[model samples]
Target chain A: MAAEVVASTVEIAAASQVGMKALGAGLAVGLTGIGAGVAEMGIGSAAVGATAENKDLFGLVLILTVIPETIVIFGLVVALVLWFV
Target chain B: MLAPEKMSRLLIVASKDQLAPITGALYRSRLFHIEDFVVEGREGYDGFSIGKPLAGASEASGGLIKVRSLENVFAIRPDDIDPAGARKRHDDLARVVDRELAKIGTEVEGLTSRRSKLEASIKEYEQRIHEITPFADIPVDLSLYRGYERFAVIAGFVTKNVAIREPAESRIVKGKSSNFIVAVVPNEDRADVESELAGAGFVASPIPAESGMPHALIDDYQAKITQAKAEIASIEMNLDAIRQKHADFLVACEEVLKSEVEQAEAPLRFATTDQTFVAEGWVPSSRIAGITDEIMKASGNRAYVAELPIGPHDVVPVEYNNPSFAKPSQFFMNIYARPKYTEIDPTLMLSIIFPIFFGLILGDIGYGLILLALCFALRKYFRGEDAEYFLKVIRNASISSIFFGVLNSEFLGFAMPWWPPYSFSRHLISEHGGHGPMIPELLLLAIWIGILHITLGRVLGMVNHYRQDHGEHRMKAVLANAGWLFVMWGVLVIIWSGIVMPLMPDLTGFPMLVAIPGLPMDIPGINVTMVLGGIMILAGVIFIARDSILEVVELPSIISHVLSYARLVAVGLSSVAIAMVVNFISIGMLIEPQLENFTLIGAVVILAGVVVFILGHALNTALGILGGGLHSIRLNYVEFFTKFYKGGGLKYNPFGLKRRFTED
Candidate 1:
């Protein structure tokens, strides 16, 4: 009976470990998204001001604002790899 | 289709008396890109100086300054008011407008000065009030606080409660408004009393220069402050009334005065002798006749227009003359640099390729429709120089996306039954019986596109080289471009045979390459076709190296440029993947299982799915636009433009009126 309790406890801990890994993956993507948001706040505002002045800057400014987004993509890729593992 | 219009130089000489008519004619014709008249000695040229402005220039400039000041005062832009209405009002005030403007200008100046003085007086009164407020409870005349030989007064603020120690004969009084105390002590113990006050964190306040009691002086200053504030408010009201009456008039007057000043000052660009003024400029070859006709007609033939024979070295201004459909692409070209008159204008090329690249990455019918709707909405709501070109590009891109979306059979993330699948749409629809990884197919398609695009550039460059007067450099360019084209084809063939063939084992019987058989000549893991491709590439490298040894380093860049097309695959794949994840979260997990029963909980789940769907699609659409638009533009600008474009031509900037409040 003592052996059975120990085995059940070990199984529960193992399941929780997988759950923790899933949580870590979620945190990675979420934190990176928040980071991208913070970066875009300043760039997006400046881009809006610039586009307001000259509409020709729309394409260039869009490119600049989206550059920080590559960070989130990297994070998402990392999260996917981790989840798969 | 690519080259800018040919330009011809014009030298017009007219009498100084005819300067007015000539300037008027030039302004009206609007075809002359007038070059700045530099006074320099040349063959058949004599002493000349820059022409002075017309007689009315001073008055016009003064009026412009005044109207601009009025604009600043009112904080109103010309576009804020109705131009047609302002023009009518301007006409109504034409006879009396100048007098009214002067009167209002002086009145505003006087009011502004008075308002500033009142503000300064108010500040002074407030300071006096502050000085007196702390001692309001002292109940002694301000004069009594000072000029006392036997008693010493130390009035200030202290954070802690005051305590009279021995040898400090003191009377401390605290005020109601703040922790400010007024203390009196014997003259002998004044320093001791101040030290006691200092120990309790006391800051001294200066005595006011008044004779009345502290409270009475404070009240008097408050009354004066209120009176001054009232005067300022009245002055502001007067200014506001002036703004209300004259904002539109000011904007119109400003526009008119500015035009007058510009016209009067136009002679500054002309080279003048004692009696004759000579104007030299370039006009489009096509418009040369039209401009001559207009100048003669407008100036009554007083100005003699002569076409100067332009030499090869003449710096001609470039003007793009494309159809309205392709005209918008000039925005992109202009921002990069105007194409030289000798080189091809790449506007039409950009118009064709930019949309294809944008569409390929964002190929989804649902998203395309959304973008199409947005384009329509933007067009309906906004109208400006900025909106016009952006909308033009977006409209083409949206249409192309719709077309590619139909080809790909995608709506949002889901596929339609009738259309071929994403990977199969571009390749053999029948042979690949099952779906394979689309990334490889997309990458291959992207590389093929790169090859074709770069080849077109090289061909255009070669044609440009041949079209020019042949020199050693021109011959080298022709050979190098031809060799690079050969290398590109070799690389394409190698990629087709080596990599694409291995992917599909079932396919067979394509074009066979000549295998160069040798003894003991083997590199580990190198393919036979690649080795053949290397030899073919060396042929181009040899030609390039003959001209510039350093240029051979750029050979690897050719492969990198082709590989850069992988962005097209990566961006599109990311968009599709995100959309699928969104669909799964919204529909697959939430609504799929309980969707059949339609209970209250199921209804809630469906509602949640709907919300998720909207938010998810919104995010995806934004990302799609950024990625699709920029990556496509990057491929055109970084890859294609670097191949052949050498853009540093002067844009043709003709003198013309920016008519805002007036029709003529």
Candidate 2:
């Protein structure tokens, strides 16, 4: 009975470890997306404001808004790194 | 630093006597007043000075003349000769000249009328020639071949022949064809004609008819039209010069006659009235004393002067001032200042808060340094009115970024040496778990910021209300806003503590309250306390709703306003989540031992990773800035302003001299 209990405990510890690794990976990916979204929120608003002020700024606004998307790309890299590691 | 000062006094004056001198001085100084008054009774003076001499003259001779108004005498002194005469003598001479010119003018009018008739006749003949030219000639070339012989036939005839068929009758030939012989040939059914032609056994191949007169007539008409058109063009070119000379002569005669009439009547009596000569103008404050002295000298000490405070009208005129006169910095301030009179100056507020917010969101020392460098560089490059505004914004943002970077314990992505050299050092340090300093702390800070911002907005709203004649309403807004803030803070604090820990226990058998199994959970005591705290918040919300609804007796409307602050959490959460993602991506990529040593591969990976990270964060920063800024403004304008602002005041504008283009 003692042996069985010890084996079960070991199995549970290993499972928890695997779960943590998975959770970390998930967090990395999820955080990246969130970051990207947050960055875009500000950029998008600014772009729209600029475009509203001057119709000629359509291209410039678009470029500026995309600049914030880098956050998401970074997030993606982290997610990939975590998965590979 | 010296306190800034503004221009204080301005005066502008317009008068008939000083018009010439003042205009000349203004032109030389490149300063003038914009006059917008409509002349109410100009017709009374139409004939009064109809022939008056050009102002600023000494004598009259030949083309020189004199004009006398009721108040002043003027003579046109031509460069070539002196115009010398008493006002009355000049006036008599002018009358005689006018009488002679009038007689000559009549004759000229008759000549002009005759010339017009001649021009019309010439045009008609030109048009007739053009019409006759195209169809003038019909020529025929025929080749006839018998079995053993060949002959060529050529003929020319007029296509359009104009003839006097009778003594008074004329016929214009419409069509003449070179193929007339062929057309006149009879068919076989005309047996007599066919038999007569066949009797000779001569199979006749008749050549077409031709004419020469139509061609000649067309050419003749074309030449005539061209000549006429040339003559008309030359005459039209000279017409303007002729008219100008005539006009000048008439004006000279009229001026002479008017001078004579003025002398004959009252010897140019100067009309006097006690009109004080009130005028207003704008001058650089530095030059105010000089301008006042000059004005007094010119007015003969008959003007009153005073200074007015710099109001909206004093600073920026409403009419006749170019829109571009507003400096970019002033314009930016005006964006938040002038639109709603009751609102706080957003320029001042933005100058304070935007940098702090940016630093909080971005929070990396290395990144902050980069931003500072970039901002400074951009400031140097873009140095103008607009650039000044940008520089101010960037200067503030860079300071905030640096401050946040220190607080967040990040230099680049690397942990500072003072802290544990690990990404989760703070979390690890607090693992003994009593009140942890970690992600949760960061989130709490964001919430605290929101609370402060909302509170400030409410305070501003109340102030605005009080200023706009709603003292009672302002008091209510203040109370309601305070009540909610206190309730939210109190509840949040209770939930943060573990007072109710004993009510529920976790799987570890520890005392807990309100713990949920199989889900991420905080301590039970904190959870239960949060529930209680939530009730307090709810109560405060109800009270705020009641106050707003009661003021307008519209209960439903208050719900929308209360819910609006929810965006505060939404935006904050978005920023935090984005940061976490960036950190994750930066750490996620595997660095194999063998590949790590390969400089090229490592460099490539690092470059790609850095690029992605920077781009992602930049995007997030931009988005957060814009979203937070706009929503922040929206909250102020709608939820807050609705509580107080009354913004329909007309902007005051004053007329002032402005140059559209500058030569120097």
Best by DockQ: 1
Model 2 C-alpha RMSD vs. true structure (Å) is 18.1
DockQ of each: 0.10, 0.05
List model 2 lDDT by residue over B473-577, tens digit each.
666666665555556555544545533222222233333456554443434433544555567666666667656755334333333344444444344335545
What is the C-alpha lDDT profile of model 1 across B1-664, one tens digit per residue? 6778888999999889888877877776777888888778544557888999998899879888888887787687776565555344334544565787899889989999899899999999888887787778767788877787788777777878877765444455655644777666778888877787788888888877789888778888889988998899998999999898887667767766776677789889888989999988999888888989887877788789999998787778889978778887777776666788888788999999999998898988889999999998888666565577888888899899888888777778777565456443432122335553344455567767877888888888787777763778888878888777767766765554444332333111344445334523231234556566677777888877776788788876777677667667657767877887888899888878668787998888998998998899999999999889888887777677777877788889887666676545
Off by over 4 Å in 2: A1-85, B1-300, B305-346, B380-384, B420-437, B470-592, B595-664
Per-residue C-alpha lDDT of model 2 across residues A1-85, encoded as one tens digit per residue: 9999999999999999888877886787578668868888988998898879976565445545554443443343344334432
**How large a fraction of the reference contact set does each model reproduce?**
0.03, 0.00
Lowest summed lDDT window (length 10), candidate 2 chain B: B67-76
Model 1 misplacement above 4 A: A1-85, B41-44, B79-82, B85-97, B110-149, B158-162, B166-179, B199-201, B207-245, B376-383, B416-437, B467-470, B502-535, B590-612
